[model samples]
Every structure is written in C-alpha cells, then in structure tokens.
Target: MLPVEIKSILEKRAKDGWVPEHEAKEILKIAGVPLPKSAFAATRQQALEKAEEIGFPVAAKVVSVKIVHKSDVGGVEINIKDEKSLEKVWERFEKLEAFEGMVIDAMTPGMELFLGARDDEQFGPVVLLGLGGTAVEIYQDIAIRMAPLEKEDVLSMVRELKGARLITGYRGKPSVNLDALAKAVIAFSRLAMDMAGAFSSIDINPLMATPDGCAAVDARIIL
Candidate 1:
C-alpha cells in the first residue's frame, strides 16, 4: 500500500504526467532511500532559513514544473557558502519564467553514481546503476536488473560496471560502503515496483557514494 502522503502527491499531479523534483525526493525518502538534507522554500526568507537550518555550503535550485533541465537555464546554484550568496541566487532564480520556489539541499561530496528505474513493457519494472554526473553519457558504463532487487543483485550490478573499481576504491581514494549502497538500491527497486503503474520512469543522478553511505543528490519521476 502506498503511503498516504505519496498517494496524495500522485493524485494531485496525476494530470501533469510527472512529479516535480522536490516531491520526487519526498517520495524517495518515504521509500527509505537515503537523500541529502533538503527543504522546499517558496520565498527568499524561507530559502535563507532553510539554508541556515541545513547549514552553509549548500546547493539551491529553482523548482518549477516547466523546467526539467535546471542547470541549462542557470537555475542551479551550488556551493552557497553564506546567506549573501543564497540571496543572490534567489534574486536571479525569481526572475525565471514559471519559477515556483527553491529546493535547498546540503552539498554532499562523494563519487557520483546513478540509479534509475523504468516501467518496461516486456519485463515490467527494471532498475539501473551507472557512473553518474556529467560523464555518465561519456562513460556509457551501466548495469541493469529487474525490480525488487536483492542485495546480491545490487552488488552484481555494481560489479558489472566497467568502472566498478571506482566503487571498490581507486588510487588512494577510500571505498564506498557497499552494504549501505545495496540497501538503498533495494529500496529504490521496491519503490519502482510499488509505483509501477503510476510512473513511467525514475532517475536519481549523482547518487553520492562515500565511505559512510549513499545519498540521492537529484531525482526526477515521470508518470
């Protein structure tokens, strides 16, 4: 059964064919997916408050239903070290068309990775893992498995990646916690299966993997 809050969001956006990034993250949180600390603010003051609450050196992005690729339109501002920078971001973002508010999140550092799920017509729900960030396309290294993945399945997907060594630690860099990552993947897969009919696809880019654990940095859900 879907959580009442998630069901409410889906019903409200049923006609839109997609869930906004902030709301998508909310759904992921409810599904037990780890995510960076974040909050939605509809005003500059609120943005500032949320930023302070989450601490400095955060990332703030414009939230709007019409804007899918935020960075393309200068809707993303990262490494906001203080209130002044956040205010500046607010002033600029407010000028954009269809501006709704801002989603302020703590800046997380780690190896970038991608996790996604799609409702495949022939195979039902499927999950994918890959090298993330801007190089995801350039690397073209990924692994996929059907939804409801077990811990072993998640580990296997990680191993199948050509850049799997990156996760296991490379050149003096510390290795990420594979156990935590597997738990996250299992949760994401379960979410995919739970929302199979309501969503067409789900993407979590830059799933930050660190020695401590993993966290979703950004996400999108298409209905």
Candidate 2:
C-alpha cells in the first residue's frame, strides 16, 4: 500500500520513466522518499509531467561525476517558482564547468532537522541526531546511538536533542512526525550496517520535518 500522495507521484513517474543519476544522486533518493518533482535527467516532456505531478515551486540542481553535494559546490538552485527560473538556471549551469547535467526535482517545505549514521570500528553502526541550521557546525547539537535500533531507540535519540523540542511541536505543529523521521533514521542505520564496506559515513541534514512527512533535502555517503 502506498500513501495517496506518494503513489500518485510514483505512478506518474513510472508512466513517464525515470532518468538515471549517478550513485551519488541515487543515494539521496531512496525507496521511501517522496518528491513533488524529482527526476534523474528526465526528458523535457517527462520533466513537464513530473512538474505537473509534483506541482510548481520546484528546485533543480546539477548532478556531476566530479561533485556530489550540490550546495557545497554552489551547484544547487532552490524555490524555483516558474519555468523561467528553471531555464535560466539550467542555461547558466550548463556553462559552468562544475556541473555536468541538471537534476530537476520538486522542492520540499518544512522545518529543518538532521540525521546521520557512521560505522565505528569499535561500535559498529551508530545513529546521530543533530539540531539543524546554518550553525549546525558551530552549535554541534547532536546525539548518537548504536545501530540496528528499535522504534524506542529512535524515539529516545530524537528527544535527546534539546533543540528537538522546537523541531517536534514548537509552534502548533503535529510534532513533526518524529516517528516518521525515526523510521528513516533507523533504516539509514540498517543500510549503513549492511553496506559498511562501501562507505565510512552517511549524513542527511536539513531533512524537512513537514506537517505531512519528512524529506532528506541533503545527503552524503562518504566512501
């Protein structure tokens, strides 16, 4: 069974087919992710279809072999309202050497949060929860737990962050669905544990904890 919203998006994409991105981009778009408009170098016609499926107020970025984190390298554009912004960025991006091709996707909206998994030689897989923002590094507000976690463990980690009080339900929000975020965290942990040989770390920061759900806006799988 699929959520009404996600099933609709997937069906639309399935009908149109998906453009394949490098392993870097694909790692960010997991089986559980739902996007308003997410495509992997999809055709122009398919891009329009995805836009319709996901709706306006989208985002587009450059996916290249040389780069993985778009924002880190100034390859990301966000909150694209009209198609004009889309073409404008696309053209400018094409001229830029840092970018290879464009990755068009729907923009997600909500509060920012962080989750990560790291394989420790001594501890095996460990999960992390951090207070997200421009000051994530300065503040360094994060909590950690061992992997292969239960729902209860995930819940505890989320609560461990003092900032999480604001993330959960600070301003008339429905607690930002920590359960949903927790499930993603646990799954990421399991994935890290399963694929430990391939990477040293995985980070999903500024994960939007929306009223409806959560989306990993940014990710890094260090290999």
Candidate 3:
C-alpha cells in the first residue's frame, strides 16, 4: 500500500501536474530514501530560519511550477554559509517572475549518481541508474532493469555500470555505503511499482553517495 502522504501528493498533482522539488523530496522520503536535512520556505525570513535550522553551508534553490530548469534560470545557489548569504540568494531568486519560495537543504558531499523510473506502455515499469549531475548525458553510463527489484537484482545493476567502480572506492576515492545504496534502490523500485498509475516518469538526479549513505538531491515526477 502507498503511504498516505504520497497518495495525497499524487491526488493533488493528478491532472496536468509536475511534482515540485520539495514535494518530490517528500515522495522520496516515504520510500525511506536518505535525504539531506531540508525545509521549504515561502519568504526570505523563512529561508533564513530554515537555513539556520538546517545548519551552515547549505544549498537553496527556487521551487517553482513554471521553472523546470532551476540552474538555467539562476534559481539555485550552493554553499550558503550564513544567513547573509542566504538572504542574497533568496533575493536573487525572488526577482524571477515564477518565484514560488525555495527549498533549503543541508550541503552534503558525495559522488553524484542518478536513479529514475518510467512507466512504459509495454514494459510496465523500467528503472534506471547512472552517472548523474552534468555528466549524466555526457557519460551515458547507465543500467536498466524491470521493476520490483530484489536485492541481488539491484546489486547486479550496480555492477553493470561503468561507474560501478566509484562505489567500490575507485582510484583511492572513498567508497559509498553499498548496503545503504542497495536499500535505497530497492525502495525506489517499490515506489515505481506503487505509483505506476499516477506518474509517467520519475527522475532523481545527483543522488549523492558517500561512505555514510546515498541521498536523493533532486527529483521530479511527471503526471
């Protein structure tokens, strides 16, 4: 059964809906996917409060129904170390006509990766994993599998990727928590299966992974 919060979001965005970043985070949260400590703010003061609450060195990005490419529209600012910095970034985001508040997230360092799922008319659900961030398309290093994945299945999917080495302490870089990553992948697959009817596509890019765990940094759902 789907969680009530997720069901509520799906119902609200049922028609001509695209899940916003904050709401997408909530959806992912229901799957028990680890996420950066975050809060949504509708005003500069609120953004400041969230920033302070989340802690210093946070990231803020505008949450707008109209702007799909936040970075392109100058709606994103990172490493905001203090209230003053957040205020400036918030002010800049406010200038955008489509401004609709922002999501304040704690800054976490990790190797960027991707996870996504789409309902295929013929295949039902297909899950995707890949190198994320600016290199997602550039590398095209991805793996695909059917939904309702088992632990072994997700582990195989990870090994199939050329970037698989990254999670195994590639080139002396720190390795991510493989068990945590596996759990997240399993949760995502279940989410894809559960929400197949309400969503056409679900994309989570830059799902940062470190020795501690993996966190879905940004996500979107098309209804």
Q: lDDT by residue for model 3 over 115-213, one digit each (tens)?
A: 999999998888998888966888989899999888898789889998789877877787788888889988999999988777898888879988989
Task: Give candidate 2's whole-model lDDT.
Answer: 0.64
Candidate 2 vs candidate 3: which has greater TM-score? 3
- TM for every model, in the order presented, reads 0.97, 0.78, 0.96
Q: What overall lDDT goes with each candidate model?
A: 0.92, 0.64, 0.87
TM-score of 3: 0.96
Per-residue lDDT over 56-138 for candidate 2, one digit per residue giving the tens place of the 0 to 100 score:
77777776545654667677788878766666776766665545566666787787777777778898878787777556788
Which residue window of length 10 is worst by lDDT in model 3?
A: 9-18
The residue pairs in collision within model 2 are 36-54, 37-105, 37-106
Query: Residue 170 lDDT in model 1?
Result: 88
Instruction: Tally clashing residue pairs in candidate 3.
Output: 0
Clashing pairs in 3: none
| Higher-scoring candidate on lDDT, 1 or 3 | 1
lDDT of 1 by residue, 1-223 (tens): 6889988999987887788889999999999999999999999899989999999999998998888878889988899999998999999999998899999999999999999999999999999999998677788899999998999999899899999999988899888999999999999999999888878998898899999999998998888
By TM-score, the candidates rank as 1, 3, 2
